[model samples]
Structure formats: C-alpha cells, structure tokens
Target: MTTLKKTGARLGTLPLAVMVLLAAGCGTQQAGDTVKAYRRSYPTPSTPADFLCPGEDPEPTAATAAATAPSATVPPTDHYAENHGFRVPIPLHGQNRCDGLTVTERVKSALEPLRKRGDFAPQHVQNVLTDLGYPAGKVYQDGPTGVGFLIVIDASPWCVEGTMSRDSTKADAFGGYPDGTGCEPPQGGH
Candidate 1:
C-alpha cells in the first residue's frame, strides 16, 4: 500500500510538469509570431546613396551655377535702402513733395512737445507724427541701452530721413539731412 501511494504522487506531479512545459512552448511561439508581425508592419529605413558627411563640400553642377547667376533684365534701383532689415516708415504723401516744411521741421514740431513731458508712451509720439501730417511706423523702445524711443518717417526727397532716437527731451534724425543727399526718395522713400 505505501509503494502504490508513492507512485500515484509521482504520476500527479509529472502531468503538472508536462502542462507547464507545453504552456511555455506556446508562449515562445506567440512571442516569435508577434516579432515577425512587427517587423513586417514597419520596415527599416534606408539611407540615401548621395548623402554627404559633415563639412563635406559638394561640387556645384552647371545647372546650379546658372540658376544662381544674377539676371541682367533687373534694373539697378535703391530698393536695398527701402527694404533694409529694420522696419521702415510709410510716406505721408503718395510721392516726394517740397510743400510746406521739411521732414526735419515736421518731426521736431511733432516730437518736442511729447519729449518735454518726460517719458511719454511710444504711441503718443506716433500720434504726434501722424497729426503733424507725417505718418510714422516702426516705433522701437530703447531696452537697457537707454537709447529712448526711436521713430521712423517715410519722408523722401525733402528729407529721405527718419528719427534714430527720441527721448524725453530730444529726437535724433538720420538719413540724408540738410540737403537730402545719399537718397533717391521719389519712389517710396528709398
């Protein structure tokens, strides 16, 4: 009776071990299938054959050189000055005119009153210029540099000029002054 009981216990443990082994084999097969499916869904990316390494200079082709060449049809104009990196003001008048007063005088009259106030807003200066018949744009506030409020005016020919800095007491104008030299300001205050 003791021998039979020991054999029965061993037989029960053998079936459990076989079931665990079969489950492990099934799990391995599922994992392998999942890996195969993922690989099929997303293929590996390929590098371009003509890719250049860092600091490698490529030889310019004839087509690229021709495309970069300057065109002869374009006439040389003072467009560079007009479209400078800094924002420029728009002209009050459609074209350059020497009518009432010069741009300098107009700007001075507009800004002096505001400057006397001792630290007025930039909008106030812009309004003064607009009210004085000179439309102002690109108003910049001086940050840490103590440069003050800088205003730009599209005053051509008569002044081809604008203000560089406008503080609490004064405003500084730049571009051709006194005689309006170094300016071709008839077409859009260039």
Candidate 2:
C-alpha cells in the first residue's frame, strides 16, 4: 500500500534525523560528550558486592570461627538447621485482604513487649509467638528476618510477619501464601 510504504519510510528516517539533531545540539566534542553521558547514565558493575555494611563487624560470628577451628573434632555439620529449629513448617493461606489490618494490629500488640527487650534477636520471635497462644505447629521461623504466623486469633486470613533492619524493626500482615494459607511465603525464602 502507498500509505504503508510512506509510514515505513518515515519510521526509518525519523530516528536518523532525530539523532543528527541531538548530536548537533552538543556544543563540542559531540561523540565524546555523548559517550560520557551514556556512561554516566548506565553505570557498569565495576565492583563486586562485599555484603558487609559499614560499621558492621568485619569479623565473622563465633559459630563460624568455631567451625574453622584447627582443633575441630569433625567437619562443620552439613545440616546446620537440624539443631537450630530455623524453618518450622506451618499451614499456609492464599492472599486475602479482608481482615489484614485488624489481624495485623493484633500481631503488633503481641510483639510490643518482645520488641521492648533491649537484646531482641530473631531467635526470640518464634518462642514469643508460641507463648501468645498461636499454634506451635502453625508458627514458622526463619533466619534473621523474623517469624511469620497465621492470624488464628480470630477468623481472618492473614499472616503476621516481622522484619528487622540495622536501625529498626517492623511487623505487618500480608495476604496468605500462594497456596492460600496465612503462613510464610511458600517454600520459605525470605
């Protein structure tokens, strides 16, 4: 079609004309300036992540040091989680927003006292939730990212979860898991 040919021709040349105008707008050293602008806009991965935040302990934890100790009786345990009780499986619920806010507030109140502990750590979260009448089997615990549990306090579909940062902590309720139970995200990678 004549119209299609006209449109295709415009599309091909439009970009070239715009590029020429843009380069002309550059005051001097057009190619170098464009290259520098592009480089600044799209930074390359010049350095690998160290994973250590500033002011954090550059040294590893005591457990890690013990694992590498020259006097170790055996190699470090491969099933590190067997003794730690890290991932406690729980019933999961799918996403729902109906009762999230109310159940979330309950979770917040329950965590208030524990949060007051000057020495609060992730490990304490599971025990505290269990003491608050949440079903022990229904409470799930993961590593430093705090714990998650179903809102069994009332008829609600929400999972109360907590998270911590170097400077602060937070708790909120989210819609249940993918399979539709109010527990930690399915398969449990925080």
Candidate 3:
C-alpha cells in the first residue's frame, strides 16, 4: 500500500515537470523572437500605392487608345455616276449600225465575218450571246471586239460579245484596227 502511494506521488510530479518544460519551450520571449524573425523576412507592405501604380503613363497605350477610338467610315461606290455617264453621255438606243435586226441581229451579223475567218464558230457565238443576255433591246454595238450593250430595263451596260478574238495572237488581224476602235463601214452597206 505504501509503494502504491509513492508511485501515485511520482506520477503527479512527472505531469507537473512536463507542463513546466512545455511552458518554458513555448515561452512569450520565444514567441516574440519568432515574430521579430518573421518581420525581418516579410514586412507588411508599406505604401500600398507602390504596388498599384507602376509609373505615370506619358500617353495612352495602343491597347487603351484602340478601346476608346472612333469607328471607321466606309466610302461611297461610284456605280451611280458610272451608270449615269453610260446612258446620258454615250446613248445606246435605236437601230444598231452593223445590222438592222436590233442588237441580236447585229451580233449574228458580226459573228458571220468572225466565223468565216475561223476566229469563232456559229454555235459558240450563239451560246455566249445567250449567256450574256442577248437580243439586247437597247442597242450599243461597236466593233465585235468592242461590242457592248445596256438592257432596256437595267442601267448597267455589259460587253456581251467579241471583246477578245483568237486572231488577236498577231497584232490587229481585224484590218489593223486599233483595239476597241470603230471599223470603217463596208462598201455598199452590206
């Protein structure tokens, strides 16, 4: 029974000594030393504006200016003036000079010479003319190479046929006529 009491007293003294050693190891002075070491390693950020402002910008940057810049302006098309000139200045109406049968007959007539000269075939010329909106009611015939027309209904003029020739390999096989120049009328009006 005396040995048991001695053992209990030793155990109580052991817990008290352990608590004192723990308190000394984790003392306020030790905590203060830790705080001072932390301050030296990483101080609280002073004057937070140093992080906020890198430097005063002399002028707005490209990124900033682009965000604030005005939108671009698109230019107007010249088609309206071009169409007016085609109609008013260079009238393309009434009987075509090449053949009497409007623009359609004129194309057929023009193709006759070219076909004979082997520059174009009949069927090819017909197909090309059909694709180009043939029988143009408003006549605007010139040389086969320069033949152009405006539809009776529309303002836009189209060069329907003979703007190019197989004979063009040699310079001016069509009687040395300048490109897009008018040809002299054939004798006896054929």
Query: In lDDT terms, which candidate is top?
Result: 2
Q: Return the TM-score for each candidate structure.
A: 0.30, 0.33, 0.22
| Clashes by residue pair, model 3 | none
Candidate 1 structure quality by residue, lDDT tens digits, 44-117: 86422233323323665787344323222235466674354233322222223223124555566666765555
Candidate that scores best on TM-score = 2
Worst 10 residues of 1 by lDDT: 91-100
Candidate 1, superposed: residue stretches over 4 Å from native: 1-101, 144-190
Backbone clashes in each candidate structure, one number apiece?
0, 7, 0
The sequence of per-residue lDDT tens digits that candidate 2 reaches over residues 1-190 is 9999999999999999999998778556655887898899997853232243333356969974443232222444556543322333322222332244444455566666665653255446556666666654344443453444443444554456654333344555543444444454445433
The order of the candidates by TM-score, greatest first, is 2, 1, 3
Question: Against the unseen true structure, what C-alpha lDDT does each candidate score?
Answer: 0.47, 0.50, 0.39
Candidate 3 structure, TM-score to reference:
0.22
What is the alpha-carbon lDDT of model 3 when measured against the actual structure?
0.39
Task: Give me the overall lDDT of model 1.
Answer: 0.47
